[model samples]
Every structure is written in structure tokens, then in C-alpha cells.
Target chain A: MLGLAAVPLIADVIDEPFYTVMFSRMLILSIGAISLNLILGFGGMVSFGHAVYMGIGSYVVGIGTFHAIEDGISWMGNGLIHLTIAVVFSALTALFIGSISLRTRGVYFIMITLAFAQMFYFIAVGNDNYGGDDGLSLYTRSKFYNILDLSNDNSLYYLNFTLLIVFLYFSHRLINSRFGILIRGAKSNEKRMENIGFPVYRYRLVAFVIAGVICGIAGVLSANQTDFVSPAVMHWTRSGDLIIMVVLGGMGTLFGPVIGAVAFLFLEEFLSGITEFWQIIFGPMLVLIAIFGNGGIDGILVRLDKWWQIKK
Target chain B: MNWILLLEQIMNGLQLGVLLFLLAAGLTLIFGIMDLINLAHGSLYMLGAYLAATFTNWTESFFVGLLLTLPACMVLGMLLEIIAIRNIYTRSHLDQVLATFGLILFFNEFVRLLWGPIGLDIQLPEILNGSVELIFGIRYPAFRLAIIAAGIIVAILLYLLVSHTKLGMLIRAGASNRQMISALGVNINLLYTIVFGLGAALAGLAGLMAAPIMTVEIGMGEEILILTLVVIVIGGVGSIRGAFLAALLVGFIDTVGRSFLPDILGFFVTNDVADTAAPAISSMLTYVLMALILAIRPQGLFPPKGV
Candidate 1:
């Protein structure tokens, strides 16, 4: 958290805008990981297609702007309106997908979600208006009601940073509430929770929708940051990346997703800079982590905290 | 719509279905016997294709190259099982997914590193290259017919081994109840390794057959892997018969839909609208079919006995 806060100042001292931009990307991705963690880490719903919501969010922005420019309706391309549509569309799709997907458990659930994501991917690629497989480039960043200039890099970075903090607080409060406990309980043992008179399905669906909405917001921000939205953003591998981030940071921890996003993105930047086939190294590292690092970075930190207390 | 064109499409669909069955057979068996989801099963298929491409170049004989690929893929599959996958059999499905997903990344990059990102072309031998004239003046590629014949033979062999042989009996028993079979003093570990190897061999055969028809490139496994999953899901996991039937159904639906959906849509809507929506809807038909089947029978069309 302290490191996040200090990024802007560090960027200024280094005289490099890259740090701010990179951290902004991390912040947006953290938002995505945090949303995924809500259901996957706490609710035990391993959605292999969670990145679809992100893609939907991005296409909403991309498509809206394309129409606005084509038809010359300036109102259609407004940032707030695009955000609203993204949130609503994503939440509704989540509701439909979750209701069906949550019916099956284990691998069935995983495969069904994956099929839905693939369906959306093919649909996106089939749309010629949105650049088909190539994706659409945004001519202008989304405009607010003149309250803040998104074209300014610093403004966009701070906006993303502020939202990241807000979402962290929201998730923290959410998991502590009574609803969070029920969701977590369902994850650990569904039959037991159902036997106790809890409507497990509804809780799971709500959590699924919430997570989808949050990720959708992240998607909107991601489109703004990149100034482009493509089918590649919603590829199944990106969903895998999100899952990796949550697991690496520590499942069921508030700040774990944030830590994971930073680590993952930085490694990606660092490794890809060195060689083209960076996955050769990253893949084995992921396998080793799954094999050995059960608790992930947060687990290691907790142990360090315990050792410090004992030493004191 | 000419009768010959329709006949050709049906044959193409059947060919695709046969290939899909080869891929899904290993996947379903692994899922049945071990209850592990190996995402990297597709990686094995990719490896087989790459190895076949390399061996074909060396031996200059496609048939010999294929024969060599079978043992190589089987050994690699067993090695993967013993080294990485064995440990995760006891772990959760999520863990298995993550670990295997890692393997996919590793294998894809590894293949890219070796193959240099360029697709390899596998030329058909002289006999299989030409189209065979059928009755009523219809002609079909001999290679496709050979693939279909090979797939059927493998299917029959798999059925015989499962129903007639002791190892096959052990596999069915293991799938039904792992603990009971183990309690009866069966070496479940060895059985698992064999099953994994067999599955790897099957996937490799499919890849080798497909090399001449499709582009042998990186991530080809993933493109087909998802379709194979849809096949298994619709067919019912852990059922070889189910995979066979479902693979054909999905393949026919997909191929036929891609070919005929635009024409069907044009009958109702304007040409422009049909052109735009047809591709999207056509691509989505199989998924829609899977979803419908799932809604009606969550266990799939033909679930294994006692599962």
C-alpha cells in the first residue's frame, strides 16, 4: 500500500512517465484480480472465463465511440454512459451465465464458463464493424462532464489509484459483513450450508454478479489506458492470468490481488523485455508455485510477521 | 443446394467428428480413471504433431513417421504423468487446472522455440493424396477415408481392450470405484500411467492425421481442445461411447452450420443482415447445442454407469 502511494513521487524523481503508466495498468488489473478473488478465493467458484467481462466492458467503450464517430452523436461516446452500460451489461450477462453455470459443480462449471467465454470470443471476432480480429482503436480518451481531463496522464493515473483504494475498502467491508460469511461458508461446504436453511445458490449468484460488475469497471478503465479494445483482451489466457494473480498474491486476502497484479505485470514487462518467449520461464515458475507454494506471497508474509513477533 | 455438395459437407463433418473423437477419447478416459482435468492434454497433441513433422522430414515416409510418433508421445505422456501430474491427482481440480495450465504455457513456448513460429506442412503420400471417385460421380479424398477407417479401428480396439482384456476390466473397475479396485490389490498407479499413455497416443494419432490437412503451428492444440471439451461434455464425461457420439454430433452441427447458416438466414432476413449475423450465429451453434443438452441433462447424453 505504501509502495502504491509513493509511485507518483518516484516517477517524478526518475523523470519517467513509464512508472505512472505501468502502475496505472497494475491498478486496473488489480481491480480485476480483486473481483475474481471475491468469488474464486472466497466462494470457491473457479471461473475459467472471468476475463470475458473485461472484454465486454472494453468493447462497450470501443463500440460506443465507434458509433459516436460514425453517426456523429457526441452523447453516445460519453465516458459515464459507457461505464454505466458496461456495468449493467456485464452484470446482466453474469447473472445469466452464473445462474446456469452455478447449477453444475467442479469441472462441469469450469468447462461451461469456458464455453461461454469462447462463444463471446468468436462473436467478438465476427464483428467486422469493431475491426473483427484486429480490434478497434480509440481516437480520443473518454470525456467526462469537464470535471477531469482523462487525456492528462497524471489525472488518469490518480483516478485509477483512487478507485483501486476505494474498491479495496469496498471488498474489505463486503467480506466482513454477514453476506460474505455465508458465501465463504458455502464455499467450504455447500451441503452443510444448504442444510442450515441458507439459500446457497442466490448468494453465489449475487457474488458472481458483483465480481463481474467490478471486473467490468476495470475493463472500462483498461480500454481508456490502452486507447484500444481488442478481442485479445478477453482471450482465455487473460482469465488464466487473473487466476494466477489471485493465487500468487494469496487467496482470500484483501491486498493479495494488488500485490499479485504488481508482481505479475512487472515480471511480464521485465521478462518480455529480455526475450520473446518469456512464458518458458514463467510457466515452470507457475507450476512450481502450484506444487509448493500453497499459501503464496501472503502466506510467506504472514510467516515473516510471526517470526518478527517471536524475535521481539 | 446440389446433392453432391450436401454429401461432401456431410462427409467433411464425419471426418471432423472422427478426428474429434480421437482427441476426446484420451481426455474422457483420463477424466474418468484419474478424475484429473489435464488442460495440457492438448499440449500432448501439439507435441505429437511437431514430432511427426520432424520425423517425417527425417524418414521421408509419412507412415513410418506416424508409427514413430505413437511410442514417443506415449512415453512423453507417461513421463509427464509421473513427473508432474501424479502429484496433483490427490489435489483439487483447481490445482490440477493451474498446474496443467502452466504446462500448456511451457509446451507452447517450448514448441515455438524449437519450430521458430513457422507452420510446417505435411505432404500426403501419393496414394492418399488423390480423391477417390464414389458412386454417382462424387469424389472424396482418400486420406480422409483412411482417417475415418483408422479412427473406427482404434475405437473398436479400445472397446475390445476395455471389455475383453483384464487391463480393460481393471480400467472400468477403477473408473467405477477407485478405492474398491485398489483394495482388491490392483496396482492403480500403473493402471493410471497406462491410461494416461494410451490417451496421449490417441491424441497424437489425431494430431498426426490432422497435420496434412490443418496447419501445424503453435497453439493448435488449444483451438481443438475446447471443441473436444464441448464434445465430452455433451457426450458425458468418462464414457467412450458418449465421446464418440457427441463428437460426431458436434462436428456435424459445426460444419453444417458454418456452411448453411447464411443461406438459412438469408431466407428470412435481408442479405446484408444475414451476412453480418450469420458468421456470429454459425460459430455459436455448437455452444448453443451444448448448452441446450446440458440444461436438459446435466450429466451429459450418456453418463457412465454408476458415475
Candidate 2:
């Protein structure tokens, strides 16, 4: 609730083109991270290929805009159709990969997902038509009935913000549903869930597909925001970044991924400005967090809340 | 493809598979025995290559440089284990992943700082620089053949050590049940350190050997590390025998697919389409194999007993 009120005030302070752009980027990434948390945090599915959904989303925007520009198609015919295709495709791919990957527990799941993501990355790089290593550019942003002028910074930022809110609400509701309980239970103990007559694999697969679809939506927003898409979006390191965001925010919480994404991007921007070797500091910082800060930023907040209660 | 060319490619694939095995063996063993995920294992490989390159430049002798650098990598591995890894044995995979990933970023940046962003080439020894002619006029690189031979020797030695030696028995036992082994009064800490160091050394050995063939640069380990992880997954975590076979399967599939997929696809489609699609398909081949294997056997081809 505090965050809800602070949003406009924070926006008013950084009410510039650059800050608007950065904020929108953070929102899109937060959406992706939140989607990942649904599967990884709640369902115990450690996917190293989550970035592929983002790539799929971005490519949908890029390809849709590209063909629309060349063919003069209507916004509904081009933009909406392409976006639908992207979400469906990403979900299907996630379903196929997750079905097999979820069969293996623990380290095997992690490695297989990583490899599959890398495979998609290589395929994207190999496709010369899609700009290969250079990436594809949208000549213009998708014409969304001009209801939301993506070309305008403020307008686009709000659109992303609205989308983020919708997705967060959707995710929150999902987690509190009966389906969510099964997923959480499966994560806690797969054997127990199975013994309780829930088909653990089926629930996890559904969660995986849902996560993929959400990430696909984020990817579309990312493509619209940047007006570009590339194989780099699907790289394993990119997946690692998403995982870091989730961990940083405090996995399984409603606001954790958003906080993580905002903090991470801001840190990257601030640190990179200080020195070219920013990663040297950032890397050790992550290690320190892992070693000492087990619960991430949100975890610390919870601890503080408990302490305050004790004091009272 | 000509029979001779096919034979050459197969040999090349075998060589690549062997190198992957050396790296995967260490990774799987550590994961299986210590129950720790070490994402920075690739950094040790990069270090070995960098150290080998530096020492070779210093001594002007590849063999001598390798001899000195191998033990150095082992020590570095042990030291890192003591300092960072030992503390995380009881932590979640997420912590291990993040911490090790941080190490990778640090090491990559550190390497960039030390050696510029450009890749360095490690020259092969003059004695092993040339190619050898086999039957049917086929020729193969001596260095590649040496890598294959070394891989085989290591595999045999590892097999002997794991199956025959007391330490190997302890390692196998520890992998199956760590608490039970500790209850038997074995020094778990020392065992973990040694296992981690051994794993590092094996990864380093792969790096040193591969330095001549592949580019030596920052982030070079990332791609190969993914492949090594695949090998571990397919072979079954903590099983040396599984790592060996899976590594070979991955190496052969990747090499052969890259070489022949385009030509084979051309027969069915237009050359232009085949040319464009082949690379993508070939790159996805190993992953397809991995997915297929997991779908059939979730525990991998030979999951260590009790893992």
C-alpha cells in the first residue's frame, strides 16, 4: 500500500525522458522476474531458460512490426495477432520443455533448462533473417489503436505500469487459489503432494506454462520499449539475471521481484556510471548477500518487522 | 561425405568429447558427493588456460608450463573451496548459484582487466603441431589426438581410483550417504576439500589442453560450461561412467551435426533454406537429445545409487 502511494511521488521526482524509460524497463523486467518466481519459488522448478520467453515476446513485437511496416497491415491484424502468436508459442515451448525438464529434479532440471535456453539462443543467432547477432529493429512501435501512444515516453511508462499492476494482481490471486496451494505443497515436498493424490507433475507443468506466458508478455513490452529484439535476450546469462532479480527481492513474496528488479537496474545504472569495472564490485556483493543475507531485502524487512513487534 | 572425412570428423568429435568428460567428471562428482552446485567451476577452467598461457610465455615451453600450472590450479581450487565454498555446503542451491555466479562475473571482469578483452591464442608445441596421416589418406591434428589419449588415460585412472582405491571407495560411499560416512568417523571437511580440488584440477586440465584449439578469453567458459552441465545431466549426477558416455554422445552429436546437417538438409530442401536452417537445427541437436533422455529417464542414464 505504501508502494502504491509512493509510485506517483517517485514518478513526479524523476519526471524526465530518461527516468521514464528506465522506469518502464524496470517494470517490464519486474514482470518477467515475478513470472519466474511463480515457478521457481513456489513450485520448486528452477528453470535456467526463463529468458527464452522474454526473447519470444520481443521477437513477436519485432517481427510483427517488421511485417506490418512492409505489408501495411492493420494494428489488429499485425500487432495483436503477432502478440497472441508470441504468447501461445512461448507457452507451448515452455510446456514441451517443462514436461521433460520437470521430470528430473534438482541439478538435472537446472542444467537441462540452461541447455535448452542456450539452444534457443544459438538458433536465434543462426537466423540471418532476424539480424543474427546484430539483432532486429522495429522501424516503429506497434500501433495499438493509438489508445496508448508508445512513442510518447510518459504514455508508454504508464502502460507498462498498468500492465505490471494487472499481472501482479493476477499472480497474487493465482497464488492464493487452490492451484497455488498445490504448487506450494509440491515445492515443499513432492512426495507428500503425490501421496495426497495431486499429480505434482501436472501442476508444475501448468505453473511453468503460466510463467512462460507472463514472461512472453513482458518480452512484448520490452520489444516495444526498446524497438529491438536479439538473441542476446535469450542468453543463459540473461536468465541468470532474472534469477538474481527474484533472489534479490525475496522470492515467493508479492512485491519482492519488483523491488529486486528496480534495485538491480538502478544499481547497474549507478555503478556503471562510477567505473567500467562495476561488475567486480557487484559480483562480490552478490556473494556477500548469498553468504550473509539469506532472505534478501524482503527477508531483512520481515526480520525488522518481527523485532519491532518484540519491542512493542 | 567421403569415408575419410567422416572418419576424421568422428575422431574430432571423440577428442572434443574427451575434453568435455574431464570437465563434467569433476562437476558431477562435486555435485553428487558434496551436494553443492559450483557455477564457478568454469572459472577454474579459464584460470588454467590463462595460467598455462602465461607460464608458457614465461618459460617458452608448453610442457614445462603445464607441469607447473596444473598443481597451481589444484591449489587455487582448494583455497577457493576453503574460503568460500565450505561455508555453503548446508545452504540452498539458490545461494550456491548466486555466489558462484558472482564469482564468474568477478573472474571474467578480473581477466578482462588483466588481459585485454581480445582473445589470446596458445601456440601448440612444435612436436605436436602437425597432423598425422591415417588410413585412406585421412589426416588428424596431433594435438587433438593427444587430448583424446589423455582423456582416455584419465578415464581409466579415475575408474581405477573410484572402484579400486580406498579413497575412491570413500568418495563413492560419501556420494551415496554423507551423514553415514561422517558417522563412520571419516573427515568430511578434508574429503570435500580434496574432492573440490580434484574437480578443479580436472577442469583446469581440460582448459590447459583446450587452450590451443579454442579461444582463450574472458567469458569463454560460459558456453562450454553449459555443454559440460548437459553432459553431467545426461550421464547422471555423480556417476563417472555416466559422465564419460554422455560427454562422448554430446561431443559426437554436436560435431557431426554441425558438419553434416546442412549437406543432409540440402538433399531435401533448397540449398538457401537448408543453409539457413541447418545451423539452427544443428545447434539445437544436443539439447533435443538431452530433453529426450530426461523424458525417458529422469534420473539420467546412470544416476548414482541413492542420488
Candidate 3:
């Protein structure tokens, strides 16, 4: 946290301010990845359309700003309204998508989610009022008047960083709570959980919504960072990328997604720099990981910790 | 309403259905027998197109190219099953999903490297390039007509192969009870490899058929892959018969809806609203169908055995 807090100052001193901007994206996606871990890692629901919530969050901001600029709908420009609408609307969307997607288990569930996300993506691509396939741009960041100003990059970065920390604390509490235990237990053996007098479906559904809401907030931040919203925001490949982050970091561990997100960005950045066909190498690595079977980068750290303790 | 135009559209839908069936048959069988989901099934479709394009360029015959593409696809399929897929059989569904997803990345990039970023084109044979006129002056592409005919032929062949042949009996036995079949001294591992190859060959055939109409390009698999996934899901996991019916239904809904939905919606709404909603709704139609079906019958329309 101290090192992250110092990023802006360090970037300015080193005259390489792009690091602050870049880290902002990684942190936001880390939040998204973490949200996914709630269901994917702990609750045993692999939602292939997790990023659709993020896209919905973004479009809320984009549509708000669109109306604000085009029709003098100033209240739509308020960050509070943006966040509230994003939250409520995303929760509702998640409910609808989850109800349908959760009906079938295993590969069927994955396909349904992928199919539904594709539906949303196509709708965004088709809506000409929101710039069609070109996407919508924010004329100005959502405002809080005297209370906050997102127009300042530093303030925005600080706000994102603060939110990330708050989310970290909240999720930590969430996973260890009784509710969290129920959700995780359901993942282990849903039939037993149901037989033990818990309504596993409802429990899973609630977790799904909570995860969607958090990921959606990350989407809002990402849109704010880019100042644009498009169907590309929730493309299946983007969702796949999020899943990769969660898996690569460590599924059932907190902070593993953060590690995964950072590692992913680094791998993408470094490998792309080496050659354009980086997927050839990166693709096989995932296969090897899946076949070998461990938690992820966090899993590696955990094993190392055990080894060190034994040595001592 | 123009019945002739509708008929032409129905033909288009049928051709698409045939293509989907080819892919879905293999997918259903693989799932039924091996209990595997190959997300890279679509990648095989893509490779088939690329292979057909190359072979056509060499042999100067599309039919010969297609013939050549099938065996090639089977070999590639078996190789993939042996190399990458063989390792992940007992892994979790998540592992299978991600690893196959990895295969997609590898196959997509591998294609890009070998074929270049530009897409390849498959030329239709001369006789098949012209239009076939039906009754009432309705006309359709002869290539598409050939596709439907070929699909029927293959479906018949597949039916005979699965219903009568010794291999077909073994496949049925494997699908019903893997342990019993293996206990009976059948080579279970070899059966899996052969099934995977069969699935790949079918997907490749679909790809080669699709190549003439659409560009033989990278990532084309993902789009059709989603559609085929929808088909198998709606059809139930293991039943080839279910896959067949579901593929035709989805293909018709997609094609007919895309072409006529605006007009249909315009009946009850303003033209502007219809125009705006048509594309979005058309694309969503199949997914919505799947959701609704699963809601009422989560086992899908024609599930054969316990999920």
C-alpha cells in the first residue's frame, strides 16, 4: 500500500508518469478479477460473462455522460448517480443472467454465460444512439461539484487506489464470514449443503450478484480511465483474460488475483515487446498450468513458504 | 408475404443447419463417449478451412481438396488428443475449459504465423457456382444446394455407420457405459482418440463447406463455435439425434430472424424502433431460446442419459 501510494510521486520524480496511469488499469482489473474469484474460486461457479457486468457499469457512465452532453441532463453527470445506477442496474442484470445461466451446470453453464454476454455485446454494437460500434466518449468525468473532481488524474488515481483497499478489506471479511462459509461449502458439495438445510441455489445466486456488482464498479473505474465506452469492453476474450488472471494469481486466495493481474500485465507487456506472436508461448503455458494443477502464483508462494518453514 | 423469398431464406437456413449438424454431431459424440468438451473444436473447423484452401490451390479441385482435408483433420485431431488433450482427461471442467481455451490461442496464432494475417479464399467449383432455379422462379446458390445434399448424404452415412457397423455398436456401448465397454476388452484409450478424430473431421467438413461463403480466417471458429455450443446445449449433451434437431432449429431461427425480424417487428411498432431492435434481437434470439428451454427442461430437449 505504501509503495502504491508513492507511485505518483515516484513517477513524477523519475519523469515517467505513465507508470501511474498503467498501474491504475491493473488495479481496477484486479478488483474485477477478485470479484470473479468470489464465485469462481470460492463458490465454484465459473461465469464466462463476468466482464459483462463491467461493461454494463461502463455503459452506465457512458450513457449518463452522453445524455448530459447532448441534452443538458446535468444530474446524469453526477458520479453518485452514475455509481448508484450502475450498482442497481448491474445487480438486476446479474439476477436475470444468473437465473438463466445457473440452471445448467458444468460446460452448459459456461456456454450460457458466454452466449448471454455475446448478446449484450451485440446490443451495444448495434445501438447507434450510443456511437454504435465506434463507442461513446465522455465529454467530462462524472462530477461531485465541490466534494470531488475526477478531472484531475492524481485525484482519480487516489480514489481508485482507495477503493481497491476498501474492497480488499470488504472481500476479506466476506470470504471468512458465515455467509462466505456457506457459499464455499456449497462449492464443495452443493447437494450436501442443500441436504443440511441451506438453500444452496439462493446462496450461490446472492454471491453471484455481489461479485457482479464489484466487477461492475471496476468497469466504471476502467471507463473513467479510458474516457470511452464500447462493446469491446465486455468481449468474450476480455472475460477470458479476467479468468486467466484469477487462475494465474491463485483462485481460492485473496491477493492472488492482484498478483495474477500484475503478472498478466507484465507478461503481456514483456512478451508483446519480444514478438507479436506472444500467444504461442502464453497459450501453452496455460495448458501446462491446467495440466500440472496448483493454485497459481499464490500457490507457488504458499508452497515456498512451507518449504522455508521446514528448512528452519 | 413473398413465399418465394421465404423459401430461398429457408434453403439458406437449411445449409447453415447442415454445417452446424456436422460440427454438433462430433461434439455430442465426443462428450457422450469421452466426457470431454473440446473448446478447440471450432479451431479444427478453422484449420479445415485453411487446409481446404491450401489443397484446392494445389489440386485445382474443391471436391478433391475436401476429400484430402478430412483425413488431414482426423490426423490433426488424433495428434491433438494424444499431445494436449490426453493429459487433461481426469482434470476438472475448469481445467478442461482453460486448457482448451489455451489450444484456441495456440491454434489461432499458429494459423496467423503460417497463413499470414490475411484470410484465405476457397474457390467453388464452376458447376456449383451458378444459381439453381426452383419452382416459381425462386433461385438459390447451387453451392448451398450441394451443401444440403452432401449433408443429407453424410447424415445417412453417419446413421448407417452408427446403427449397423461393429464400430458403431462399440461407440454406442461406450456412450452407454464406459466401464462395461472397457471391461469387455475394447481399447478405451484408442476409442477416445478415434472419437476425437471423428469430431475433428466433422468440424473440418463444416469449415470447408463454410469457407466459400465466408473468409477462411483466424478466429472464425469462435463465432460458429458459440452457435454450435448453443446447438449442443439445446439438444442435450450426448444425443446425436438431439443435436441434429437443435442445430436446424437454431440455424433457422438465426437466419430467418436476422432477415425478417425487422419486418415482423414493424407490424406492431414504428419502423425506427423495429430497425433499431432488429439486429440486437436477432443475434440474441438463439441464446434466448436456449435460456427459455433450459428454464422449462434443464436437461435440454432430448437428453439421452443422466447428466
* Per-prediction TM-score to the true structure, in the order listed: 0.98, 0.96, 0.98
Ordering by DockQ: 2, 3, 1
Tell me the TM-score for chain B of model 3. Answer: 0.98
> B289 in model 3: Cα distance from truth in Å?
0.5
All candidates: TM-score of chain A: 0.97, 0.94, 0.97
lDDT tens digits, residues B1-307, model 2?
A: 6777789889989998999999999999999999888899899999899989989988999999889888999999999999888988888887889889999998898888898798887767897999888776778888998999999999999999999999998999999999999999999999999999999999999999999999898887888898999898889888899999999999999999999999999999999999989988998999899888888888889987775
RMSD of each: 1.3, 1.9, 1.4
Ranking by TM-score: 1, 3, 2
TM-score-better candidate, 1 vs 2: 1
**Scoring each candidate complex against the real one, what DockQ results?**
0.78, 0.79, 0.79
Candidate 1 docking classification: medium
What tens digits encode model 3's per-residue C-alpha lDDT throughout B271-302? Answer: 99999999988988998899899888887899
Candidate 2 segments whose C-alpha is farther than 4 A from its true place: A1-15, A74-78
Among the numbered candidates, top lDDT falls to 1
- State how far residue A44 of model 2 sits from its true place (Å): 2.0
> What DockQ results for candidate 3?
0.79
Fnat, model by model in order, equals: 0.66, 0.79, 0.76
- Candidate 1 chain B lowest-lDDT run of ten: B1-10
